[model samples]
Each structure stands twice: as C-alpha cells, then as structure tokens.
Target: MFRSLCTTALLVPLLIVSTTASANPEVDRMFAEQDANRDGVIDQAQARAEATRVFRALDVNRDDERVIAELDPQIASGSPGGDGFPPDIHVVLRQATMQLRDVDGDGRITRAELQQAFVDGLLKADHDGDGKITRAKLIRMHQGVVSPAR
Candidate 1:
C-alpha cells in the first residue's frame, strides 16, 4: 500500500506538468485574428498599431500615455466594450513598452525593441524548451485555467 501511494503521488504531478505544458488557444486565435494582413507573422508594426488603437480607446483622457495602474483595471475588466480587447493584448503591449524603454533611455520606442520584446516573451512562455507552446500551456501558466493536480 505504501509503494502504491507513493507511485500515485508521483504520477499526479507528472500528469499536471504534462497538461500545463501547452499553448493557449484563445490567445493564439486572438493573434491570428489581429494579424489581419495574414503575413504569416504578427510584426511589430501590427502590434504597435493594435496597441495604439487600444490605448486610445482606453485612455479616456487622451493623454497619449497609459500608466500600469490606469490600464490594469481596464485590462482586468476586459476594457472599452468589456470585450474590447484580448487580455493578453494588454500584456504584450506592456511588455513591448518595457523592452523599448530598457533598450533606449530616450523614452522613445523602436521596431527593434518591439521585436525583441516579442521574442523574449515567446522564449519565456516556452518554459519546457519545446520551441513552441500550445494553447493549453499558455492558459495554464497565465491564469491557472487548467485542472489542479490530484
């Protein structure tokens, strides 16, 4: 009985890890949908354009700047029309801005910075070094939307 219990316990975590190591379909779909030009990749220009649109819509004050505190609630509540933007969109935009800021102290953003940000994000999210993250892994990692280990 002791040996059996130990085996079960070990197996449980393995199952959980396996399940969590996948990408998020909703996120994937959002990316695809937004890549309207369908260039087989969502380039920095596309990302920035989308971000600008979202920022403008949410800024309310039209100050051309968005602070994390001001953005977080709108992001959490789904923004604008409540279904106004994908949650990950906000994350991606914020990450891009941070990367740009880090690379250049001038407070100006560049395409290279945005590209690096996206690449870095992909690398971080691909936790298992599998070169790709399925929808399930993304959801599991970000929101704990997956089932818990037994």
Candidate 2:
C-alpha cells in the first residue's frame, strides 16, 4: 500500500533536492507543499501521513492494490517540467518500489513492506538526529555539505 508511496516520498524529494541550488528555491517550494504545519521541517509523523496520502491517491482501483497501470493517468496528464507528477518519476517509482519493497520477491509490495520501506527511508534521510528532515538539510546532504551521522 505504502511501499510505492515511501519510495516516491524518498526519491521525489531527494531528486528534487539534488537539483536545487544552495539557496534551493525548489526545496522551499517542496517543503511548503509537504510541511503541512509550515513548521520548516517534515517530521516522521508528517512523512508517514504524506506517504499514506500518496498511496491512497495512487490506488486508483480502490482494491488496496497498486500496479504500474495506476500511474498511467498521472504520467499522461503531466507536462514537461511542470510542478506535477511526471512520467519519468513514475517510471523510477515503479522500479524502485519493486526493488525495495518486494521483500519476498513475489513481484508485489505488501502492506508490511510498505511500512518498513517508509521507516527505512525516513531513517536514512534524517541525518540531523532531530527526528525531522528539513529542505535545507536535504539540499545540503545532496550537495555534500552534510554527511549522515555515524
């Protein structure tokens, strides 16, 4: 359910953060969008909530299942370089979700795997020991200005 969502949450934000400048206007926009409380950081609870929301949105069939076809609409409706879900992102999302969340390797992501993936992704990205990930922190991590805690 949330495996793809977790992968998307990690990849999309990291990919966007990687392309941002030190000032990172893009990061600011992304933070604004995801940081529901306008608190300047995305905590684990917020990340989980977002991951769930993203999962629900992509579950087009409403069967508690997610397949590659479910992403077609979002991909088809996306514009080049627009601030919306794009085709390439979905492609990567599909592959990454399969790779990371298919724990039994049965070619499907189960609910347990989704929850684990979200926790793993959060732990990997939360480098500040603050239990939160801020846009500035992400940009700095990508820019090699900040290293993960040992």
Per lDDT, the best of the predicted structures is 2
For model 1, what is the error of residue 59's alpha carbon versus the real structure, in angstroms, after optimal superposition?
1.0
What are the RMSD figures for all models against the true structure?
Answer: 15.2, 5.3
What residue runs in model 2 are displaced by over 4 Å at the alpha carbon? 1-10, 13-23, 74-93, 110-119, 144-150
Error of 2 at 81 (Å): 5.5
TM-score of each: 0.39, 0.63
lDDT of each residue in 15-121, candidate 2, tens digit only:
52363365466456546656899888877776666656766666656776555455454443342443445557778755764676567777655545555655555
Please estimate how well model 1 matches the true structure, expressed as its whole-model Cα lDDT: 0.43
* Clashes per candidate (backbone, < 3 Å): 8, 0
Extract clashing residue pairs from model 1: 22-134, 22-137, 23-133, 23-134, 23-135, 23-136, 24-135, 25-135
Model 1 residue 134 distance off true place after TM-score fit, in angstroms? 13
Clashes of 1: 8
Off by over 4 Å in 1: 1-23, 78-150
